[model samples]
Target: MASYYLWRSKFGGLSVPEAKRLKELETENGRLKKLLAEQVLENEVIKEALRKKW
Candidate 1:
């Protein structure tokens, strides 16, 4: 337990609310990254379709 707290504080001594906010931010970041990846894939598909001689 002591070692755990020591490691936790070494990384970040965030309080309860701060830790909660950090978790929320991390979740939001992950969601946004996934959305951006999907959008980029869609754009690439569109570009490929447009490039084909029709």
Candidate 2:
């Protein structure tokens, strides 16, 4: 449970642009985390491939 005023103030004194930016950053962060996980999996696959080839 959250209060609107508190949320808005945290986003920057009740500014719409600030709220939007916060949401955008959150979304970007989520995407980056997902990408990182994918890259880790890819790295493991590459490592296994190298181990077999060399």
Candidate 2 residue 7 C-alpha distance from true site, Å: 5.2
Question: Candidate 1, overall lDDT?
Answer: 0.88
TM-score quality measure for candidate 1: 0.78
Q: How well does each candidate superpose onto the true structure, as a TM-score?
A: 0.78, 0.65
- Root-mean-square deviation of every model: 3.2, 2.6
Model 2 scores worst on lDDT over the 10 consecutive residues at 5-14
Q: Going through the candidates in order, what is the number of backbone clashes in each?
A: 0, 0
Instruction: Report lDDT (Cα) of residue 10, candidate 2.
Output: 78
- Candidate 1 residues lying further than 4 Å off, grouped into runs, are 1-12
- Model 2 over residues 1-54: C-alpha lDDT tens digits? 368667755764636886788889999999999999999999999999999999
